[model samples]
Target: MIDKRLRVVLAEDSVVLRDGMVELLGARGCEVVAATGTAPELLAAVAAHRPDVAVVDIRMPPTHTDEGIRAAVDIRARTPEVGILVFSQHVETVWASRLLADGTAGVGYLLKERVARTSEFVDALRRVADGGTALDPAVVTQLLRGGQRHKVDALTPREYEVLELMAQGHSNRSIATLFAVSERAVEKHVAAVFAKFGLRATDTDNRRVKAVLTYLAESGS
Candidate 1:
């Protein structure tokens, strides 16, 4: 459950879908600060509201091809604090990579049909709002398959497992629980994964994000 009420800006070209999402999010205790249909309107709404998160569709007005994702990228450039959740029917790996080019924090990409449950959607949104990732497993799989074979191959099986869970936005404690291991064990695995990826502690960079970035970059997705 979301610890705090979230203020959101929603962008979807389909009026029915947009309205439905507004109502659904409201029912789930989120305040829809603004709901828009076009990319321009979506950008304006986000700039005006500075919402906790923005739920965006990949297609929008005019061309309806990739305006939404473009707007999302722009939002990332101009308002890094606003979390973005790309909810689309299609999985555009190129668009996903572009959205996550700079960082993974406060980002999520989930296929609409795969969401299955409202609770899951809300949980993903909450995670993104809290500066965490919420990538779909399919997306993670594609990224993993595309990454540099040599780099990926260097990890031990356990380290690879930890990396996958990390990409899915699982905290060390959560990963530990899932593996039925101690948190310290999870941390060791995480550290091993980081070391294998050549990620080191830095004042200006988040090693975890960098590790995920390396995974995505090598994937060329």
Candidate 2:
């Protein structure tokens, strides 16, 4: 079940946009406790108010080379309970990887274009607040290359497809149906993928997620 309207803190350099965001979020029943620009201010706002989630823009004043990412990482380290949503106008997989490294729920790296739809943006915020990782589909595709590793390139083409679909949250049976294969065969392909990545599929469901994330990391690397 979803929790109560989340307490949020936003970080964006644009005055007009930030004010609009606060109003939008407030209408959706979210309590925006703090708002600021710059990395240090963001870190400070989160620390002072302790919001349930943080929405940060990648670029801000003074050497915006991933300052938001660093601030978000620090916030995550200091306050693991707080969810983080990072938006960027450009593809920045380097920062994306840092936010996703923990595999913890309630973290996202969404492209700014995806936020034009008020409902979609609010959904992303709610997803993060509820401990779900909702990485933008585009970000997922872009970051897939960083997941590449020495041996991961050896995975069969179909296996790679399986991994991608799995990352999209499809089950073995679902994948099998999509590919017109038996569930048993799908399971075997999944196993082969795990073995190729040297990942343990011990927990069944968790293994699928792990394998997909691993493949993304390797392919992107």
Candidates' C-alpha lDDT: 0.82, 0.77
Give TM-scores for every candidate, taking all chains together and pairing residue i with residue i: 0.72, 0.69
Q: What is the C-alpha RMSD of each candidate to the true structure, in Å?
A: 6.5, 7.5
Q: Where does candidate 2 stray beyond 4 Å?
A: 1-3, 146-193, 196-221
Please write out the lDDT profile of model 1 over residues 146-219, one tens digit for every residue: 54445767878888788777766678898899999999999998788778877778765567765775554444
Clashes of 1: 0
lDDT score at residue 37, model 2, on the 0-100 scale: 77
- List where candidate 1 sits over 4 angstroms from the true fold: 144-210, 213-221
Cα lDDT of candidate 1 equals 0.82
Lowest-sum lDDT 10-residue window in model 2: 201-210
TM-score of 2: 0.69
How does residue 156 of candidate 1 score in lDDT? Answer: 86
